[model samples]
Target: MNTSSDDASSTSESVSDNDSDNVPVIKKSKASTSAGLLSEHNKDNNEEESINSMHRNHPPSVTLEDMITDICFHPKLDTIGIASITGDVFMYKYNNEETNLVSTMELHLKACRDIEFSEDGQKLFSTGKDLCIAITDVETEKLVRLYEKVHEQPIYTMTIINEHVFVTGDDDGVVKLWDLRQKGSEPIFSIKEVEDYISAMITNTDAKYLACTSGDCLTTINIPERKLHLQSEDHGDELTCLGLFKMESKLLTASNKGKMYVYNWGEFGLHSDEFPNATKKAINCMIPVTENVVITGGEDGIIRAISLFPYRHLGIVGQHNFSVETLDINNDGTLIASSSHDNDINFWNVQYFESLNVTEPQKGGKRKWLEHNLPSSKIHNRSDFFAEL
Candidate 1:
């Protein structure tokens, strides 16, 4: 698994796709949901619009008038927050077969680069090219707080660390940690360790440290100590996104060179393993749908399922006409929604994987597997991480 070799994971099997499936859905646009999103709806209020014909030929989607930049699911609900290039935030509720617009707000003047829901799902935080961060109440659909010039450069990515703490990264490599409990707008700690803009960031399960991908390297920042932990050796390509799986024991970083760099947990200075994607194309976005399986969006517009440990290429989960810009799984891991460079957000039925008949099942149940449900909760096996200090 440490080599750049392609193994069983390079297969061409494709999981089911919703591209040509027809399922009736109810769509109700509450307010300002008309643009940028579309679903089957009733012409009359309280009416369940029945259109079995068009639904058969079309995939369920949220048609955005403007290009979508980033997307995320509510921590505890069936809702999702979609960030548009126009800086608008749209909240929509989706289930197995229906979608309803919760609310929408024009939060920023420029493009909204990222959006994240609070841990409790009561608020949504959005940052964008306008250099501002907006906090909106999900229930009331009203703006709660707004900060101007949150960063010197346009904010590009964001991640909520916990219920009260959140982090934002800018185009100039600045990473700022903010606390909602504090009355002032100043960040708890502002670190600029990378030379280029940040592409993605993922904090460990405990929110103790954040592993960020920027330029060609991976960096770890100690949240409690408020210091730079260390930076991994440059991987020779632009790192795009980050994912933590194996119960947070392994960290996976996607690169522009169509590779998945795997690292030992808490050991971010170098990669322990490398798995070249089947397509050998740039992996722009990815999410772990299960413990060992991750759905990756490629440069060629195919969504592939990839398994790790003893790595294997599961198969294609879905596809897009353009490169996928973002990918996210719902709260229950039943559905995965993908957004490409276009205005459509395609939702794939991943719920089927949840109810697999486990006659000794191994991820998607096509091969024998190992016990990936690790027993240890420790981030790593090392016992002397801070002894030198």
Candidate 2:
């Protein structure tokens, strides 16, 4: 794996020159094996050119030397911020034609754990296993803020609350809300409500509550009061990811046991609904595609499109040879980016789902992730829409 020091600006070698062309054959350096995790998936798609393998053949993707830990798409562009195990974060501009390295930040002594683009897309916030918090100016590629000792343990998760305020959680379960307007590295409000590390965190649209999931529980903090709102009873499994859908009224947390524990946004204690994963493999990462559809990456290396309300796995979006780690969608709802320990980042065209929501139907979205792709005749991808909203 090449660190920022080794080769930060490595250009994408395999790319199609045009978007209208046939799906490009994006191949990885690693070979596939069924050593383990071969229970149900083995029977689902057995062929090399399986039906679910989207595009003309193999879908378009980038395979870097470094193992990817997390993916954060830009809020306003087609840029992607990738955190690597080598303690560096690389930003790249990608499309169907090319993937060009834009910038690279060597911010931590250990691995960069999480990264978030500010709401305005002006600054990039990152926390790492080095117990540090860094804010980098997007335009200048310079460090604007750095808290060398922001936490006692490694910071695992973080969320942007508003224009000035943001929150972070550490491996020791301490949650700290910080303000850019504040001078010191210390948080404006600090609390420790969970016994285990915070695995994921999300805030509602109103930014009134901060929902955090941990190894065994979920914690909610009232933002206006700056205090713990409620902590749920032990969920008996590690909650890996969090998402809000159904117009932000319903909440769901993915578990290590391959289940979705649903909770009402205001009422945050025990889960009101329990949904099971059809593959029965743990969901490690997720991002909402639309209000009703969420895309999840599972422990079995498959990225899936799942629907709410009826609660069913819609279809496979993409797959890796290793357990999936993170998922993100670009500023445009058309493409979905997912990463796994396999050192590959794959993109799936999801503009099909947006066609169902927008006034005019989108075109170019094909059948690769679902049982069948949406009708491509009218499928197009628009930039103004974001699923997380």
Which has the greatest TM-score?
2
Weakest 10 consecutive residues of candidate 1 by summed lDDT? 1-10
Candidate 2 lDDT over residue span 301-379, tens digit each: 7677777766654555655666777888778677777776656777777877765543333243433323322322112
- What value does the lDDT take at residue 141 in candidate 1? 80
What is the C-alpha lDDT profile of model 1 across 114-205, one tens digit per residue? 88888778888888788899999988888999888879998888888887889988878999999889887899999999999888889877
| C-alpha lDDT values of all predictions | 0.72, 0.73
By lDDT, who's the top model here?
2
- Candidate 2 segments exceeding 4 Å error: 1-59, 355-389
